[model samples]
Target chain A: MSATLDDLDRRLLWALQDDLPLRERPFAVLAARLGVNEDEVLQRLRRYLAEGIVTRFGPFFQVERMGGAFCLAAMAVPEERFEEVAATVGAFPQVAHNYRREHALNMWFVLAATRPEGIAEVAWAIEDAVSLRVWLFPKEREYFVRLRLRP
Target chain B: MNGEALFVPDERDRALMLATQAGLPLEARPYHALAERLGWAPEEVFARLARLRAAGVIRRIAAAPNHYALGYVANGMSVWDVEDERVDEIGRWLAEQGEVSHCYRRPRALPLWRYNLFAMFHARERSEVERAVAAAAVRLAARFPGAVRAHEVLFSSRILKKTGVRLDF
Candidate 1:
């Protein structure tokens, strides 16, 4: 992932991340506000997506509200089998965000599914398949979730 | 699902949701683009989106920023072991703090991981995160007394897998 970014890229990012206007030509509105042509804004956004600078560029749903399940799961894989285990567990479509963390339980990932009940079952299956104990930590309650960074 | 679930989506609602899960096209009429792609009328798509937002099914239709790229490199997941009885109350208070981007109540993995309460604090520097964690600890200690036990902040080393929540329906 490239760390270097320019001023316009930064502004575009901050602008898009904000609640965009709910309208027919939202990007055009964004361009109008950013003082750039709609095409330039669109091209850069599409480029960001193509280059993986922005993994996603769209609506964020409250899946839980839609009866979906999301959980944070982890497993302590022996150093030798870490990659294999990661690939194995990550193959599951339910797995969304996975990370390597600095802890005894190092390989962490988020499991999500439209059918909320399926998350636990899939967690169990992942554990069984990997032959490593999986620690499934489903959030009983979320205190806060608002996240934003000033670029 | 809770017995008192806020909203129960219909087939059409699900279709609209699944279609726009990745995102709406960056166009003047984003909903128009969505409708064109999904073979539905723009009015119907727009109306459904409005209803979903009102119902809280759609949290927000906005840009998802890559924080690390913006130089906020340090992401700390702080886990706390708080007394079960007063957890909900403590969680509510912690969630209000500005530094805490995300916080949750998770079950304890006793003998291994005893911490149940988890809050993620992010910053550009590890020392900054640690300082904030320390301050948060002091604040929590003063507020909750003996109910709040030990805590640990686990920093992420790498992005093994990160993507939009992929739904297979």
Candidate 2:
């Protein structure tokens, strides 16, 4: 679906990237800042979400801060079995983000688990189910970079 | 940093997390709405959220726009096989670039994968992303000659699944 954003929508999208206030009427604060009413802000956000312009709207939790683990993994699935392997791999709840990349290691995914050990367990189970070796590339160090898309 | 010692959410906090995992209610008083849902006072809910934020458990309460819908269709994972001694410095430098969204140093699986540094770049056009990657490589080469052995930009063809880290309650 084509997203034709208006001026207000564009401003709202950009504004929403930052942290919303922790107040009783956070949206009201945002609306006042944007020179719009709270009802308009709510309506626009609802429409954006319904139209899939905004994938999610809420608090972003840091799993690592909560003692969780996240690991990046890759596997090379045969061209013929790519779809099947993807289905099997994506079936796991721990597989947070899976993508088909152009490389020998075609299937790349991220596994997130509550505990550090759960990461390996999920990888092993996925390997057993798909009958393919899963290469785990856990981050040794992370360089900070905030993601902010211009609306 | 020990996350458990930093902030271990008790049963109530877990309930709060479960309630807002999908998202906060789109209301004038979202915290109050959450308070009503969990049968807790608004003040207590706000206090817990503030504590979580302070503890770094919650990064931010914000909106995640759909990149594709926003015209950021080209997503490139730029991997560089840099010298071990300079990877961290180079990774930090790459992280500073505006084009880079995420940068990390990961273990290299020899004989198969040689790249240890990964940086993600997204743009509206594939050529734009490629240009940025090329520019970055040129800058890296100029700054640190012979530090990078090889590099490749792996563009994602499709998103098979994308549910951001849904932890079971």
lDDT of 2 by residue, B1-169 (tens): 3325646778988898889888889888999999999999999999999988998888999998888788888899999999999999999999999989999999999999999999999998889999999999999999999999999999998889876667775
- DockQ of each model vs. true complex: 0.68, 0.77
In terms of lDDT, the poorest run of 10 residues in model 1 chain B is B1-10
CAPRI level of candidate 2: medium
**For model 2, how does the per-residue alpha-carbon lDDT over A106-144 read when each residue is reduced to its tens digit?**
999999987789999999999999999999999999999
Residues forming the 10-long window of minimal summed lDDT in candidate 2 chain B: B1-10
How far residue B41's Cα lies from its native spot in candidate 1, in Å, is 1.2
Best by DockQ: 2
Candidate 1 structure quality by residue, lDDT tens digits, A1-151: 4467788888888887777666888888888998998898899888777776677887787778877878899899899998898889878878888889899999889999877788888988998899988888998888765766666
Query: Which residue pairs come into collision in candidate 1?
Result: A24-B28, A24-B29, A25-B28, A25-B29
State how far residue A58 of model 2 sits from its true place (Å): 1.2
Q: State the DockQ, from 0 to 1, for candidate 1.
A: 0.68
The CA-based lDDT of model 1 is what? Answer: 0.83
State the displacement of the C-alpha of residue B115, model 2, in Å, after optimal TM-score superposition.
0.6
Best-performing candidate as measured by TM-score:
2
